[model samples]
Target: MENTNTLTEYLTERQKFVNDEITNLIKQMDAPLQLKDSMLYSMEAGGKRLRPILMMASCESYGGNYKSVMTIAVALEMIHTYSLIHDDLPAMDDDNFRRGKPTNHRKFDEATAILAGDGLLTHSFTVISEDNQLTSDQKVFLIQELANASGPTGMVAGQILDIEGEKVETSLEDLEEIHLLKTGQLIKFAIVSGAYIGGASTHQLESINDFAYYLGLIFQVQDDILDVSGDQELMGKPVGSDENNFKSTYPKLLGLEGAIEQKEKYVQKAKEALKSAGIKNSLLEELTDYLSNRDY
Candidate 1:
């Protein structure tokens, strides 16, 4: 990886690149002005941009140019944004705010928000298909992987489980399963797919896959932790919304101390997986630590 820049600097530079690319891609889409506006609204609404950054970082960790996976990275971000848009709909989480702004459904009409999410999700595949950097086989593999992660079997299944779990008490095991699918699957795709495109060996892929799973759990645990004890202004949304929704969370299931302990366990496991993959002292490791302790 590039050793000259700190992680903060690297993130800022890469985020700008990803944002510019997303804008360019949206401009090329021959869609209605309203639809495009809704899509851009959520896309430009700021978050960590963690998924695309992880994909790019993973590729570079294996000695591949970040540009080699840039299109796929953007596609992953689009899918993530789509999920957030739909998740905030009235029929779903009924969230009014996201990233400190009115959600898509609130900014526009519910129907238009739904279409914007649909446009982004479907158009992501088109973006990948048009990438000149990847071979036909690579494109096919990535598309299948992304579909399996975000489609009915992966994130969708987890969403249903989360909804159901809200009505009843949930076990630790059950909660892990829900998050592993809901949050972890896409995270797994971001890292593993990037590494594969960067020319990882089969053995390395196996180890990194393990790392991704633990990292995903860490992310959800921290999210749950933040819901219990985070600043609304910093997070750009109200905390304790989980309790309001009666959703089961790490802090709820395991207590605050237990949740912190759980995050640490996952952090250690993630580092172990990285060491086993022969990937050490890299951006992936740094990002893992950051996720464990993030306040928002």
Candidate 2:
């Protein structure tokens, strides 16, 4: 209960901070009214705020100011939201429910949704580019980092392989490789990008990246489990969507018991990486456990 409250308080402040700053940025934009509203609508939808929280937490763990990390944290969330908007398209996951509401394509027209996703994607870079607090060197490095993490060599490539996997038989190793790229890459970026922006030592960056790899994989594994067994209100979508879509998953390869075991492997690895970092935050440690054990 104590752990939960601490995590909740930290996250609540971060979410509100990210939301306000991003809202101010959107309001200042000179886009068409409808397009701007559509983008705002998608942004307003509630989410776990996981990526931003991770970014902030990563920075704090490195002795960097969480307030200073907020903009990058918001940028990561925007990038994440953009990916989600596109991924839920009719051609992709076709998801109607996200965070207990209609997916972007359902809330707005498909064209609007696509444009909003594009807007968020490009606007995220604008935030990065226009950030005045970061040194020019830091800004350039972050730009390169964001492009790689969310670009073809990263998240997009993973999505391509995921789509391909759906249409054919995917070996277990191949599926892991695909997910490591698709989902894991951004997660890794979510953590280590903060490290880079914070100027963490190489050893520290390596530890954070190692932690992110397991964190990312464990997150996806938990998603697979939730899609199988979670309630509609909690999950905000139909269960068993993976089976319906024929997406390759840990459960598909390893069966229920085996899959649980596999998730623990990644979870343990994530915790081990955190321990090696020698940080002393109970909340960060418990967050790893929560990620692995959570139902929604």
Candidate 3:
């Protein structure tokens, strides 16, 4: 049966569950107090918790028990949080604030922040490997796939390209490549891993994977759009930072209208791919619309 809950209500309930799990995970860690604090600072700093939610939604779409993938979902969120911690460091984006709070580097020492990111990144794999719910093969598949998605050929590669592209003009194709890897890989992992664990047929997995790819692009495109037009208070950050940084964005490459059109195209393709996977009237379909239309 389709989820009857509105997206708002669904996100609230799922976010609370994810947050509780994250807090418990941190409490169980044997890390130093400072390190744990630093890690938790960013972890608790509110955002949409989109990655974990996506994994949960994908699994549910395939009739799998959401609890079965809960550990993986939390691990995925840890990875995302770690990336944000580093991305805010002076050596990187040098962002001082995130989610309206001082960034990890600002709240804690840079060294501690770096170590916190490292701790989160490395420990994510540990949680997955140690999870009692998954099979050995499932663990192997997830660990390898996560490494591939977040490592050199995936998000990191995309990040470096984004940094390099900032110094020079970037074509629309180049921009797409940058975002697809930097932002899309983990998103792909969230959906693919969840669907795989949820017992999707191979053919269905292929279609769902395609849907995830487009959704990732849609996410980035909307991010670019929000950078230009979103409310600063709601976003918990200043608008126009992208412009100030002179970074290549969808809006910069293609006027605001063009970027919106591009986002619409991605949304349409995402829906088609979801339908192809034989998933209909599910939370995934609602999320496709919600993500693109989100203000923050």
**Would you give me the overall lDDT of model 3?**
0.92
Candidate 1 vs candidate 2, lDDT winner: 1
Ranking the candidates on lDDT from highest down gives: 3, 1, 2
lDDT of 1: 0.91
Alpha-carbon local distance difference test for all models: 0.91, 0.82, 0.92
lDDT tens digits by residue: candidate 2, 44-125: 8877778887777777677666677677777887888899999999988888888889999998889999999999999998
Give the top-scoring candidate (lDDT).
3
**Better model by TM-score, 1 or 2?**
1
TM-score of each: 0.98, 0.94, 0.98
* Residue 57, model 2, lDDT: 73
Give the CA lDDT, 0 to 100, for residue 210 in model 1: 98
All candidates: CA RMSD in angstroms? 1.1, 2.0, 1.1
